[model samples]
Every structure is written in structure tokens, then in C-alpha cells.
Target: MPRSLPPLNAVKAFECAGRHQSLSAAAAELGVTHGAISRQVKILEDWLGTGLFIREGRGIELTVDGRQFLKEATKLLDGLALAAERLSGGPKSRVLRINAPQTFTMRWLIPRLSAFSVAHPGIEVRLSASIEPIDKITGHFDLAIRRGAMGADSTPFLSETCVPVASPDLLKTTPVSRVTDLTAHTLLHAESVADLWQRWLDLAGYRKLQGKAQLRFEPLYHSLQAAIDGAGIAMGPSALVATDIMAGRLVALFPDLPLPLDDFHFFVPPGAATRHVRVFQRWLLDMGLAQSPRPP
Candidate 1:
């Protein structure tokens, strides 16, 4: 018996739009115009005799039926892609696009990305950096990493702990032996994590404490570099500065007073579970577990 099916093109359009929750994003993904995606979705809706989308002001949302259908459609598409790859015999070489914060990219992921390359020579990583919040970042990416409260679909990979760090020369010139000692030394600030210093200070029972001076920089990496140059003490996230601390470039001050910050999370888009993406995700989790003190 032949199993009746919806038009695959229409189904693909609906599935993409449903996953992204936006027609424009779906059109971008499918290399079609917005009107084309709208027409295809309407075709699918008409063919099925149901309303798959409810139009809101300047946007659309999946109907209950559409939401339900999208799950099966996504799975079906993923299975089909996998079957095609298997039928072709072996995995295909591809690029995996990843977006992360500028400082984390420069100080952390870039240094560790070579291991992934060695493990999977066929898949190349296309990395991009941003200082904007994850939701505000506009671009196409297979995966994205952000340091904050975990979202529902995000996987927490690394824990962040904040501590004060300074160059050896700075310590010699203006020592920070305790919480109150910061009052005598300059403090370095990063625009991205501007609250870190205040948060740590409050936790250390010095809510009103003020440093002698302050130096502010954007993207975090600059402030850390400034700290290394003996300009001031910077609040260092443990994961980002472990290498510098280990290499004697920056010294961790009051190691026992580390302030816990949000964990880093990686988010994968719906229907993006290709073999290469899965492999890279696993490799990332493994790396995080191995390097991060946080338990799996």
C-alpha cells in the first residue's frame, strides 16, 4: 500500500518556519524569498485542510496542529538526510559555524579548537565572535556559546568563577592582600562583564568599597591584557585566564575567595543534529568535562 505524503517542499518550508518561529528566518535558511516560504506554507496548510500558522502583528506562530506536525516533520527530514548520507557511503566534509563571545573565543575556544580539528579532519569550524547578548546576536550559526543562566534548550558546559588577577609588578607596587586592600589599587573593568567587580566586592563584604582608580575596556580581553601590563587588577573568569595564571603572566589573588558566576551554555538550533554537529558537540562536552572543575 502506498503511504500518502504531503508535498516535501511544502513540508520543508513549514518545518523550517516552525523551528525558527519566523518566516524570514525560514526563507533565509531555505534560500527562498519570504513570500515563497509563505506560499509553500499556505500550500501545505491548504493540502492538509488545516491552518498551520496564526498570523500575529508582523509575525506568525504555529497552530497547535502545526506545532505537533513540526516535531514529526523535523525528525523525518533529519532521518532522510542521514539516510542519504549513509546511502552515499561515508560522511561528507562540511563547515560547522559557531558563534561565541569575543574574549572566550580569543582566550579559550581558539586555543582548544585544534583538538577537534585533529579528531575530525573533514569538518572545518567557522568561528565568529560577538559581544552582544545571545538573543540579540543576528547571524546563522550551527552552535552558539554564552555565559549566563541556562536556557531551556541550552547545554551547560563550563562553570565560571571570578577572582581578582594582577601582574607580578602590580602586586609589588600596590598589593591587594585582602578585600579592603582594593581601595588602594586601581580596578580594571570590562564592558561586557561590568558588574563582576561590584558583585565580587559585595560578596566579599565590601559593598561600598572603591578602588583608587578604574580603567574600563570592552570585550574583556583588553582589560585582562591591561592587567597583565600592571595597569590594574582585573576580575578574571577562571576559565578564560587559567592559561595566563598557569604561565605566570597573571597571578590569582585570594584564590579562596572565588565568586561563582553563571555557567557557559551552548545552544543548537532545531533540526541541526547532523552527524558532524553531533560529533563536534560531543567533543565540546568532553573537553569541558576534562578541563572544567564542574562535574558532568
Candidate 2:
């Protein structure tokens, strides 16, 4: 005689709820209602004759049995997904999920993504903007583009230099012929790169410039936009501001004083690169190289 199995929907509800530790979160992930998830979980608990969760004040905790069950359930669910994906003819119409910073997405990747789309019509690219560091083990990201020194685990894609930029109109109004002339105008600052001005100033041999009117933004994208709108001079990374400079929207101030900054790197989950990921990576690297400023 064969052993009977529990309800798949109830098992799924328990697995999702156990992983998130919140029925609401599980409901959101599964595209179901809170009550539905609660009912399914209750049914699962009754079938097993064990309490899976300890309900607390607006929260739930997994019991020992629940924890052990979740571990096994997760493995089983993952295996099922893998089997389904393989049987469905893998990589035929896969979605490549990419997470990158707001500044990079706005000024760099989004602008050039159309070409990638044109080239690979079958592969869909989904982008999510985040400045927080990628957590490979827990995150649902295929690839992450970040600006920093490349670690042993990451691959460097584009090297960058930091330069001051402002709208052409602003440059005309407040002529900055030399480094010291910047003292007369507002200095736009991005919180992410707060010390960029100081670093650029140091490179230009201006150690003791007096305080100027300053406008600070939390993200580099906001500061870049402010610079483009003639609000103030901003420290622009070469990889990000190249297109703006070429288009005559923003003018590079003191082009001679370029400060070497961290290169952009591509981080992927630990595994062999899939066909979709490999093609995208190649396209991005080529685009970055082409857009980089040529040596004079």
C-alpha cells in the first residue's frame, strides 16, 4: 500500500508562510488573501496534528516541528520548480532580473538597454533599482551592478573617474576658469558620495577653499539632475555623466582634474553563468567601453 500525501495547496501555504514568518507576506507572494493563507495553514496543521506556529501579538513564531518541516518543504519546492523549468524547455523565454543603483540606472543602463532588447528579443530584462548591497543567498536577483573596488567574487566591468559638472547655462553665468572659481558657486553634494568634492579639490591642488553655498541630496541621481538644471556644480562620475556631457546638457568643469574612482562590477549568484546572463554581461561591458571617454 502507498502512503497518502497532504494537500499541495495547504503545503504550499505552510511553506511560504513559514519562510516569511508572516501570513500577509506569504499571501502577497502567492497572490492570495490573508484569510485564505490562514485557512490553508490551519488545514495543514490539522492534517499533521501539530501546531506549526505560535501566534503572538501581531506576529507568528515557528515551532520546532515547523522549522524542520519548512527546511524539507523548501528543498522539495525548489526541486519541483527546477524540474518544471527543465521540462518547459529551459531558457526559451527567460526573464533576466537585474538590480542596480538608481544613479546608474538613470544615467547609464536604461539609456542603452534598448539596443540589448533589439539584439535579444526573446530574453526579457527586468530592472530593479536599489542602492543596498546585494545578498546573493537570499536575494531574487540574477545579476547586480555596483560601483566599488572589485572583490575576488565580483567581476569589474567599467572603470570610472570623478569630475565636476554643471549645466552649460550655469557655467556661462558663473565662469569657472580655474579651480578656485568654484568657491563662488553652489556645491551640489550627493550623500552617497559626500566626500567627492573634497577628493576632487585635493586632486586639483586646492587644499583650503572657503565654504560655499551647498545643496545636498540623498542620491547621486538627484544631485546629477540638480546640476543639469543649473542648480549647482556636482561631482559626476565619468561612466554616468558621459552622455550628458556629449549632448551639451552638462559641461565638465576642470576636465584636467579627474579623480580615479571605483569601477563598476557585476555580481552574480555562485554558479556557472547561464546563456541569458552571459549575453547580457557581454553587451553591458561592450557598451561601457564604447561610452568611456577616449584619451586626448
Candidate 3:
């Protein structure tokens, strides 16, 4: 709503000229003549009441005002291009909304989303962060990956094991030469299941951690991060945390294993299953099996 305005073609000319810092170069890129580029810049300068370009031989350079406008103009055109591409790409994906705890989102699923996207390019997977357990029946989620018991009718995709892990740095400085030594250091607790740490401790026959205040975490993934950062040791679902543990980011606290908990299940809602969901289910379970750690 100012006094005057110039054509968009002039702004395009200014942005190209600023980027290449040459009118002849801008003309080459825009597939126009040097005279056309110069005329456009003149129109822009007339509108803004500024000297935008400097004549130097057969080329040109942007003035301070042209440089400033070029920054904003380039951004607008780039955004417009992206919008056009997405809109022209066709119908939006029918999203497969998923709900998972924040820790899992950060430490696990978020990292693997790129692989999932590569495997399933057509379907969009939307993740919702929820600490509370999700009920797939009434909810909009197509599937859920959760650490709880599931009925035979449920648990569609995969089942995974649990394993104990800590950082190598923790072992070097601390006096953790044996299983009994764990009693001295702080142990991470998945407080959601009051007996999770206690059970793992018992299975490994480690007694020192018996009454110590275990560092409680609502989500197991948080405890895993703490363990990796050398905060404390946490037992985690091996299927989920295996990649990191195997990569040596977090070390397996014990070589002796415990029974894998078949409790955690990936479930798709009954009657809502589709060909795409079935394909995703197969790929995920295969990936989990492929990711299992070697025995000591």
C-alpha cells in the first residue's frame, strides 16, 4: 500500500544479479539479454528510489540496497518453488499415526524414521509422543509399539528381548570388576514397572543394588540415554536399544543374558489392516531380527 510498486520480474532480476554479482551472468542464467536484465533493475531502482547496480565493464554488481532486497527476494522465490512442488506432487499421503513415549521417539524411532521412509515411500508415518499407554481400539493410530502384555489377538508385528547396558567409560573409572560391584554405583530404574530393575538385578544375581535408590525414569529410553552419557546403568528392550549397544555407544553391563521379555508388542488394529501395513510389519520384524546382537 506504499506510493509505488515495481513488477515481480524486476525483483527476479535483482535477486539473480545479487547472487552472481553480474548482470551478464544473471541474463545468462535467466535466459534473457543483458539489456532486459538492466531494464528490470532500473525499474526496481526507480520504484525504491535507490541506485541498485554499478556498471563495471560488460558486467555489473549490486549496491547495498540491492544486496539487502536480494536476500529476502531469494527466500520468497525458494519457498514458492517448494510449495509448488509439494502441491503438484499429487494427493497427500494417508497418514499412519503412531503413538510412542518421548524417550523412544528421541533415542530410537526418530533415528530409524529415515529407513522407514525409504522402505515405504507412499505412506506417511505420523508419530505422537505419549508417555501413557495407548489403546489402539478407539484411537486413530494404525499401530503401536509398546512395552506391555498383549493378547494373542493383538501383537501383530514383532516381539523383542531386553538387555542390560552401560558405557565403557563407567567401567574404566568405577570399581565394576564383577556383578557384585554394581551394588556400589547408581542403577537406572524404569519406575513405570516398579520391579523391572529389581527383576533384572535378581536374574543377573547381583545383590548390591538391592536397596539403593535406583535413578527412576518413567520412560526406559531416558534411562538408556543416561546410561550412554555415563549417568547410570539401565536395562532396556534389546530389540530397540540393540543397535546403539552393538555400536559401542553403550556397553552391555553383563555378558550372561536374561530371558527376553516377549511382553512388548507391535500391534495393528483389527479390521483396519491394509496391504501397506502388512508390508511395513514384515520389514520391521525382519529388521529387528537382523539387528540382534551376537552371543558372548
Candidate 4:
């Protein structure tokens, strides 16, 4: 039986367009005109019988279906690229794909990533940021990092202590010398870990504490940035906010009541740990150990 397939050219165009969320960017990457990319995407949408993207003013956003399709398409394209590389006996350039939480990647891993690149220039790291837990993440990854109890195929490298953090300027405006003082200021919450503030407050024996105002942000990175900007107080894990604290952009409050969170575990699937992956794992473990704790 002959296999039925959508136009391969259209698929490639749609995949590139979807990945960048920009038709012009996709056109540039694929060495085609913007109209060519748009037509190809339209062909894909028609073939799939669904609207892949919703056009916004001067921009485009992926629909739920679009997001799902992009994940599968990306996986398929990555597999094909790898197969082609192997078949063609291409230059031996190691590409290591890593999946990690968005906020953690921004606030921690990225800052330390350059050192790894300097140490091993031969291996290229392609990082994908997602809010999903490592096990729940889609698509291909050589390894994944998440905060949780250790798993059979994972290694626990670092644990973080949580504390309330506020910008120095905000602290000057509304001092939080005591645990209850947090209630006097707006509480910035990361929707991903909505209960972090409550948990820390409970640990400090203030179970009924509520802030003057609450502002929730999707992805922990935004909340941390809000805290740095003096918008409000936020729950800061030592691993994520140590640099901010050291830079004097934010200050940790009530240091005596530190709430220890789960250790960050890195998962390496069976047979996926190549030499480059092993090197990355060693560098990660070393970085975790060498990281300095937030100052008292």
C-alpha cells in the first residue's frame, strides 16, 4: 500500500513558520519569500482542517492545535535531520538537546552556561524551555531537569531554600523585617508554584498571612523580574535569586525561616547519555556544588 502524506515542502514551511511564530522569520530561515511561507502554512492548515494560528495586530499567535502540531512536527523534523546527518557522513558536530523549566533556565542555568561552552566548544547545546515537568515534556531531549524527589534514572544535584525577597527600594518603602510584615506589601506569585508563599508563611508559623495585594504571573521568571523591579515581594529560591541578592537588586527577608524545597534532578533516558551528555552532566553537578548560598 502506498503511504499518503501532506506536501513535504508545505510541512517544512509550516514547521519553520510555527517554530519562529513569524512568517518573515521563517521565510528568511528557509530562503523563501514571506508570501511563499504564508501560502505553505495555509496549505497545511487546510490539509489539517484547523486554524493553526490566530492573527493578531502585527503579530501571530499559535492556537492550541497549532502548538500540539508544532511539537510533533518538530520531533519529526529533528529525527529526519539526525538521520540525514548520519546517512551523509556529515561533519561530526555534536548537538545536545536539553529541556528545562523556563524560569530556572533564565535565572540560573543560562548564567552559568557560558562556562560550559568555553570548556567544551565542540559540543553544541540546544536548550528548550518549558513549564512541564521533565517526565511530561514532549519532543526530543538528550536530558531534562526538574525539581522533585529523585527518580530511578535521575540524579539529584541541587536543593534550594526558599525565602521572601523584595527589591531594596521596595524594602525601603515597605520594610519586611518580620514574617508578618509581608502582609504590608503586594505579594508576587508565580502561577506555576502558586502556593510557595503560603508554604513558606506556614513554615514560619503564619498560616493566616495574606499580603496587601496579590499579583500572579505566569512562568516564575516574570514574578522574579517583578520582584527585582520593586513591584512587590516574591518567593525566591536560593538557586534562582542568589545573583539578584548578591547584586543588591533584591534582599532576602527573614533568613532564619528558610523553607527548603526539593532537589533539582536531571533525567537521562536509557542509552541517551553520550559522551557529550556525560560531560554536560558532570559540569551541571559541579556547578550545583560550587554555587554559593544567598548571603545572610
Candidate 5:
């Protein structure tokens, strides 16, 4: 006997609406209007000859039937997605999407991405850089790299330490033999690391010292570039500016006063881990460990 089924579109509408418990949210997720979701859900309810949702205060709630149906619908959708992926030449050929902050992506990850591509030629990587927080449920990214305290769902990747850095040219032109000499030079600030200078000063026992000229930038990378261009002294994260320091582009100031900062973490959406995701995760961890500063 042929299995009787409702309209696939209607089923999809119901599934998404049921999961979110809001027709508007479902519409947004499906890239449709609220009326479209409502109409499709109504069609599904009519086809089944039952009420799947109950009208509530400015929203809808899934009925008992809706909850049960949602479980089966979700399973069916997952199976369909898996089948499609398998039929499309499996996971190796799939694209992996990653979201990260702009500064980190530009100054740290982008430089090392060629190695990842060379290692995993079969998996194409798409990187998006933004400072906005990602919604785990609605975001399209497979993985996200964030800086801050690690949450329960995040995996710790790298810790950060900040030190004052200046272009070699700037340091030469404005030589400083002591920490207080910074008062004679410009101070570069990255809005992202707003309190870095203050933290460093507090640690260096120079609580009253101030910059002769202060320059502020919205992004950390901008401040780093300014420091490299001999504009001013900027507090730099070791992980992001180590290559510059080693390459003689920037010189670390008061190396003995390194200020510890927040760590970096990786987060994945809730679901079974794909082989490609696992591979990328391992590669990221390995690269982080390699780039991290080694103790003396």
C-alpha cells in the first residue's frame, strides 16, 4: 500500500512552526511571510482533520497532537537532509561555514587558512567575519569562534595575554628607557579591548601615567596596523601580534608586565557532529596549540 502523506510544503511549515511555537518565527526562518506559514499550517491541520495548535495571547501554542506530530516531522526532515547529502556525493564535498570576529579572522585565522585548505581540499570553507553575536538556533554557520569566558557549550581553544607594542621606527624615534616614558608618546586604543591600557598601567604600577596623544579605533586590527605604521603605542594580544613581533614589525614594551585576558572558544550547533566538522575542529586546535606562546 502506498503511504498517504500531506503536502510536503504544508508539512514543512507545520514542522518549523511547531518547533518555534511561533508562526512569525517560522516564517522568518523559512523566508516566507507570516500569512504563508499560517495558511500552510492551517492546510496541514485541515488535511489531518484536527487542531494542531491553539490560539493564545498574540501567539500560538502546539497542542498535544502538534507536539507528537512535530517529533515525527523533525525526524523525517533530518532523514531527508541526510539522504540528500548522501546522494550528493557525501560530506566530503559539502561546504563548511564558519563565523568569527573580524579582527581575529584577519589578523590570525586568514593567514593560516591556506594550510587548512591544502590539507582538506575536498571540503570547501566559507568564512564570515562579524562582531555580532550569533543565534545558535537560527544561524546558518556550522561553527563559530568567539572571544570571552567559555560557556558550557563552548570548547576552549586559546588564552590571550596583552602587552604594549610599537613600531620599531616609532620606538627608535621616541626611545623609552622606563615605563613612565610612555607619557611622552601617543597611545593607540582598540575599542574592542577598551580597558587594555588601563589594565597594563595598573599592573605596571604607573596608575597616573597618561598618553601625550591618544588615538582610538573601532577594531583591534586597525590599532595594530596603526602601531605598525609608527602611529602610536598599542596594546597587542600575543596570539594575534606574535608574528609581527617576531618579524620585527612591532616591538613589545615592558615585556615583564603582560596582562592576561579572556580566552577564545569554538561553538557548534546542537546536532550530531559531521566528519568534516570534527576534522576542522581538530585542525583548529592543532593550529592554536602551535601558535600559542611557549613558556621559558
Candidate 6:
């Protein structure tokens, strides 16, 4: 009988877990949940029919079988990567296909992509900018970054929250002193959801205000840019606009917590997690976790 081949991801994950000696650490490196790395390691162990590691107090120590397999798995991963490199283009040339919103990509993700590429040399990043949701089951992309709370199941990734922001200059010397002061400025509305302004008004305790504000595009990015250009005050996504806020181009407008949405997330299609993808995910998460605002 021919030997059964284990799942490629399971093997790759197991190799990382063994090398790191901690599933959580491997997860951080791979930009996946700790549970995901653990399950993959278990799947690999089941196929090999041997214990790979024994869980210790805080971390696990490699078992005898694990140590032996580590050597072989290490070689296997290296060989597979080399083979893929040659077959695709070269070891220095890998591709990471990402689908994100056009405005978000332009204003936020695009500026940071060069840094990612520098860290993971020779990888070509192919970006498909759209507001349309990616069908992970259909492999629309190898990676995705979306915004959402903790409990969302549609995506493998989650974002912090949305925050109200506008250029710092708008805040100073203007009569718009408090949350209610916002009524004086042109409230830019570029959200696809028709009720966005209403929800923001409710958050600001002005839901029943006497007049409505200015409105614009369905996609928020355009209006966000308008806000930057002093067109009006626009609610900015914390994930995509942190750099802007930090640069003093934008500042949070209110103390009240903003409304939450589970619209954004990152998804890696089944069988689509590649080394290049793994590298990119790590970089993205680092930026997100460090720069993102608290979830409302």
C-alpha cells in the first residue's frame, strides 16, 4: 500500500509549533489563532500515529517522536518551498493576493505594503481593491483584512472599532466645541449604510436634532478624504485611519464611544495559506494589534 500523505498545512503548522515549542508562539508567527495551530499539529500527529509533544506548565516540550519528526519536517518544508519557488517563478519570487476596499487600500494599506515586501523579499503582492466581500470558499484571495468584533465567524481575523475623527485644524478655533458642536460643521456622509449618520447622532446624543447634515458617497473612504481636505467631519475607521490620526491630519471628535460593526475581517481560503501569506499576515497583525483602537 502507498503511504498516506498528510495534509500539507498540517505538516507545515506542526513544523512551526515544534520549532517554536509553543502553539501560541507559532500562531503569532503564522497570524492564526492558537487553536488553529494546535489543531493542525494534532492532525499531523494523528497521521503520523505518534505523540509529537507533551504539554508542560506554560509550554510544551518536544517528545522523542517530535524531535525526530522535527528534523525530517524541517527538511520537508524547506524542500517544498524550494520546489514551489522553482515551479512558480523563483525562491525570491512569491505572490500574495489581497482583496481590500479601494479607498482603504489607497489611503492606508498601500503605504504600508512596501514595508511588508521589504521584510519578506522577492514576494509580489497582488492587490484587488473592492468593497465586495471576498468569498473565502471560492479563493478570491490568499489573504484578507477586515473589521469586526470578537465573535464573528465569517472571517479568520477581527478589527478593533470605528472612531469619529477629523483634521486637527478643524477642532481648533472652530465653534464646534463639543459633540453638539458637530452640528455646525458639514457632517460628511459617505457610508453605504443609510443610517450611519443617524447612528452616529445617537452616539453623540443628537439623534433627534433639528436638521440633517451633508451626505455623499456610499463608500466611506471618499468622504473620509473629503474630511481630511476640510470638506467636513467624517467618521473614520480606526484600523485604516490610525496613521492619519497620529500624523495630526485627523483627530477623534468626541468622547462618546462609536457604533461598532463587524464588516471587516481577514480570511485565508482553505489550502491558501502560503509562506508569503504567513509572512504578510504576521506583519499586518503586528500593525493592527499595536495601532488599532479598543473595540467599542
Best by TM-score: 1
Q: What are the RMSDs of all candidates, in order?
A: 8.2, 13.9, 19.6, 15.7, 11.4, 7.3
Clashing pairs in 2: none
Off by over 4 Å in 2: 1-91, 293-296
lDDT of 3 by residue, 56-146 (tens): 7765667777778877887886676557647888534557777666665676678888988876676788887764545533466766666
Pairs that clash in candidate 3 = none
- Tell how far residue 133 is off in model 4, in angstroms: 4.1
Reference-based TM-score of each model: 0.69, 0.67, 0.60, 0.67, 0.68, 0.68
Rank candidates, lDDT, best first: 1, 5, 4, 2, 6, 3
Q: Total clashing residue pairs per candidate?
A: 0, 0, 0, 0, 0, 5
Instruction: Output candidate 1 Cα RMSD.
Output: 8.2
- Evaluated against the true structure, the overall lDDT of model 2 is 0.81
Better of 1 and 5 by lDDT: 1
Show model 5 residue runs off by greater than 4 Å: 1-92, 293-296
Taking the tens digit of each residue's C-alpha lDDT, what string does model 6 give over 1-296?
99778898998788877764667656755668889998998888888889999998767889999999888987878677769777987667777888776776887789887788777777899998765555532566777655442122223333545656777676675645566667677777775655666777787677875324575777778888887887777877666677788788888765457676554556555456677775676576566555653342
Candidate 5 TM-score over all chains jointly: 0.68
Tens digits of lDDT, candidate 2, 119-163: 877679899888776764335687788888334445566788989
Model 1: per-residue Cα lDDT over 10-40, one tens digit each: 9988987886577875665566788999999
lDDT of model 6 at residue 179? 68
Q: Candidate 5, residue 183: CA error in Å?
A: 0.6
The sequence of per-residue lDDT tens digits that candidate 4 reaches over residues 1-296 is 99878788988888767765667656655667879988998999999899999988756789999999888987887677668756988546699999888888999999988988887776899999875755565448888888884344466677788998899999887777777787799999998998898899889999998999999998888999999999999999999999999999989988888998988878666447555775687688778877843221
C-alpha lDDT (0 to 100) for residue 95 of candidate 1: 89
Clashes of 2: 0
